[model samples]
Target: MDLSSKSGGGRTGYNPVLIILGTVVVLVGGYLISLLSPSLFPLAASAEAGPIDQLFRVMLFLGGVVFVLVEGLIILSIVRFRARKGEAGDGANFNGNVTLEVIWTAIPAVVVVFITLYSYQVWVDIQAPKDDELVIETEGLRFVWSFSYTDPLNRLAEADTQNFTDSVLHTYVGRPVRLKMETRDVNHAFWVPTMRIKQDLLAGRQTEVAFTPTEAGRYRIVCTELCGGGHGAMYSYIQVYATEQEWMERFIDVRVERILNPPTDPLTVGFNLLNENAYPCSGCHVLESVNWAGVTGPTLNGIGDTAARRASANGLGGAEEYIAQAIRHPNAYIVPGYNSGVMPQFGAEQDEPDAVDGAYYVYMSDDSLTAIVTYLCLQTATGESACGDEAAIRAAVEAQ
Candidate 1:
């Protein structure tokens, strides 16, 4: 019953060195497996990044094969050269095998060369962008992304952001679309899971990310980086249309007209005209108490209260100066760096229609402008300050 006896196979055959080597190899192999997450995958950094995937995979496979070969040798040597009980004092010392040495060296060298060549080819394919392609301009700010589709007449595939998704940005299949990306504030990344393009946007410098969306449907565009307080809501959509014309007729042209002349009736525009064609604004900004993280526009809740964006006193005259300037030229005096285009010019101040009291901001004639300004000044006014904010009119009107 004594296992230490030679007949019972005492711990006589195992070589501690081989066991150590085998354990090391297995541990290395396991570490290799853990490096397979999306984060760990060799990202196609440039346009050439995609094709190198196969070569990258091959490199991984060769690494695994090498691990197996080395570990297998250690296991075999442990068992084959084990010490025998009463048969021999020790195993014979051995030198390296020239054949084994040459095989290990040569096989890997050949594999590495092939992988390099293959990867290079893939690199070439992706680095070169197509000649004629559309460009989407993206500007990233603290916690939001603004998409500018300059193509004007066309809209990208259209889809429902929350529940239903159907028509989306109509980008062509074969054509590569270059994204000119930058940031107004901190760093952000433009990511589209379907197209597999993720590019960083840095302030003061522009970055270019390109991809040919092979898909033909609506896809999501999300900010992959934690941008700001509301980073979780920083996302958008892209509609991938089969053809160019369909995108224009359906989404682009119609929206442009709307922005130029918003509908008069008490109807909320489909998507906020602010980002109707590009990023949806339902996440931020409030619309009739609906929460959308779109601080891109002034809140409608008390818009009438601040009659004049720039007012020394909340009198009637001061409020009038603010309202008129805000309507005619938004960029003249933006609210700090928050947003310049929050209020845009539909036409010249002369061209704006007269003001009217309704849900939408309507400008009738001179009479209405006076009426709206008066109405707004009264909305959140103290009984003492009315008749016109004389100080506001003096400074603003005189400056003009």
Candidate 2:
């Protein structure tokens, strides 16, 4: 073998079939991963998801084919056209194949046209709103979310529109809901993992998005965009119901009935109040088990059990004094990462802990505060506060 003609002649030993097969294996492996990546694929679905999925599949197949064809030809030519042991001057120096060139150009143009048409359809189907769609307005802040329901009618009514500033809804589930989102402070994202829809709530601008939930459970509303010091805590939830009637029954009808036939457990009233309307605390804190979760404030979820890491960290004997003080004087020991001095004093409000503080703390009655506290402490992990994880609870106080 001469090995003189590197361009055209006896095989250069490059194997196109082997190259094509190896590439096919890798492409198939990647395609399989795409199909199984639920965490990424389950984001949100509308009519768009189906079309987008189809478009992606088609594109993937086309891309794989193109790769095989191009690489296969290169490898085949390198080996098949190379000069033999001692071949001629310039083997096969003929003109290019016009037919092959036309085939490649025409195929890509046709493929692009089809892609453009299919993508347009998907874009239209997802962006267009149906006439019967439910409309909601969302207000986002540092660590909390607010939702307002627009009346079914085209007319805007304050009475019908739940004033997020005054009374934001707990966000009923079910129905095809459309949302208009905005932010009060910084940039935030309105994301519901289950529904697979999340949109930016840009300050001073209204952003629009929509979703139709299929389940009757509550899902977290997380902020995909970083907004403030308490970014991690910037989450809320939206409850989805099996049907519209079920939604009303759980969020509205039941509340009225409970008000008429009040429960003996004060926590009942407190939690119901937390869900009834958007209270100020609903935006800045999280107190699960009693439905008092606001993103800006530290989560009060499971506060009923009572021991907290703070007292434990300081080696304090008990957590009650600190818990009470934290509420009454939130500024006294502001959580390290939080912005200081924004929380109003709840001291005067706690005077009558037996009362419910459903309204804003500044003007809420003592009964409201007590009821709020009573409801909030249920998730304390230690029957007093969420801050009291037994291990950390012990460590917190002992460390000090």
Candidate 3:
């Protein structure tokens, strides 16, 4: 057969059947690829997640179409237009078709414009303020997250402090939440994968992020930044209640009641303080009593007994002195296996500035430190305090 005739008069003409077949293949392949998107991501737990996930699917579909089209053309050309066994001389050459070039160029430009507009609209919609939003203050430290909230109704006017902090973020379905976030020590990121919202917590500055929960469930809150040694453990949760009534009954009312009638016992107060994450201790210590499972610092399971032994071995005044010095001046006596400068200095003197000459510090009131020491002093096998009475503990801390 003549090569010219075989090449359709030296110009390959478009075949309607091949065009239709290719279109079908691209459409089917793209749809199939889009369907896998749901499995590729976490559950859409917030209203914003829906739109973001949809946008992802759209982009995936377009990408699949382009991938299939390009790969298909390459394969077809290799197999169908390969040099024949008896062929000789160079194959026919011709200039590209202007119409085909324009179509290809125009298609991508239109796709780019469409994607830009669509993504912008999605972002604006998700960011729009919603009515009756529950504002929560968020703080990120080296290895912990603390969320604070105030009573919206002012029901606990008699309480000395109305604001409370927790290790978890709580909200209800259909209720918007806005977080004013800050970092106490280093730069960190607040990310909720299920909600598809992430914001950075920069040092010396505050940032904000907003989202509305659509599902009533628990979702993990992770710090996506590499903050420090305990960065992997710097995670919490957002608990979405089914309704406002449920949230009030389960979380809000309980916290308010506790605040209004604060516990009198120092042991109980200290336990609550640590349990509620008021001091960020749980992220660095392990104490089965309070369910702290951190692995960064020394274990507190039998801290009472250990304190007694450590004080005697280190020639401290008593177990109380050992515990007090451990907190106020963590570098005073470092544990044998643990390195110094790991724990923040919990300075008790209020007159001291939080930071001086670029040296960072964290403050703890004498009352709180006393209570915490009182609690830790009782974590013995016998359930008895290894340290002295409240007066002795206060004196031990004051001596430092």
Candidate 4:
């Protein structure tokens, strides 16, 4: 057994200079290998994407360097310090070196601090509010994302509401937009891969993200959080118009018309609400009248007739009471096959001290809740019971 720095074959243990050279070569070679595959990432569509991509590349380079160094040392030890053919009982044996331990530990600590500070700066830059930035309110629900657009300039002052639309997010190239996001049921992450922005939507509080689109095209808005059963279908879109004129013509004008000259009839208003996702109902229910194909909840094609029967059978007041109760307390009477705790309680208020079934949550206003129930009551497929007259619908709304 050779315990000294020399072996039986008269060979030197190892060369320090050669080991350093090999490490440098492996690191460089690994970096080159990553560069050869140029199509690893998707297209960058926002101004913040450039800096984020660069940061990712730097982190990747550092990771590759570490990988090469660790694996390289293992392979080098096996090849250079292995036992000779039936010649050695043991090779050199020594305790660990304090200097090498300190070197390895200090290197990682410094690298981590450096990366954290660098990434923090990028985050601050991206989040800083810009002058004249457009603000959009984004809501993440069970299986869809809804965006509300507020007009800052009052271009369409004649419109009754400040928000023209509440479903789709609209933006223009080179325009800085800030999203005020919230979740309805659970935690959700609003993610735009091309824009390189992702933020969480928490219940009972607001989170935000800001970005300036650099490209003029449509990009997908994905919910990166694992929210629920229908999380996979939770997606939306952002339309980046090429010019200000195009954006105004496509979005502003249409929004103004929608608010200023809304449908006067209740039927149209109800139908539009279900179809255009004014309340995110289309994502949970299936209604053929407005082409709503969501299957998360029960079908509403003949809910009017069913409401009256369910009311009578359950010893409720009437059809109006049943519909209203269904909206306010969704879990009160779950359908035969449907599960409870899925539908959101719309009329539950913060001040309402009484909690039902150990559940308390934010709910919708009386007016909005009534309107939705009125619309649902008008949906009668059989037409045998005369689908609650307009007076009954109005009375039900006023009863709330």
Candidate 1 to truth, TM: 0.47
Q: Candidate 2's residue-wise lDDT over 46-114, tens digit each? A: 333455566666666667666655675687678877788878787655669898699879978998999
Candidate 1: where are CA atoms >4 Å away?
1-56, 63-124, 152-170, 270-280, 283-400
Compose the digit string of candidate 3's lDDT tens values, residues 121-161: 99888767779788899988766787888877797777777
What lDDT score belongs to each candidate, Candidate 1 first?
0.52, 0.57, 0.83, 0.74
TM-score of 4: 0.72
Model 1 has a clash total of: 37
Best by TM-score: 3
Flag clash pairs in model 4: 346-364
Worst 10 residues of 1 by lDDT: 354-363
- Per-residue lDDT, model 1, residue 368, is 30
- Stretches off by above 4 angstroms in model 2 are 1-40, 43-48, 55-121, 150-174, 255-268, 274-329, 335-370, 374-400
Which window of 10 residues has the lowest lDDT sum in candidate 2? 353-362
Model 4 misplacement above 4 A: 1-13, 16-21, 32-43, 75-92, 137-148, 153-167, 180-189, 200-207, 215-243, 283-324, 336-339, 348-386, 396-400
**How would the candidate models be sorted by lDDT, starting from the highest?**
3, 4, 2, 1
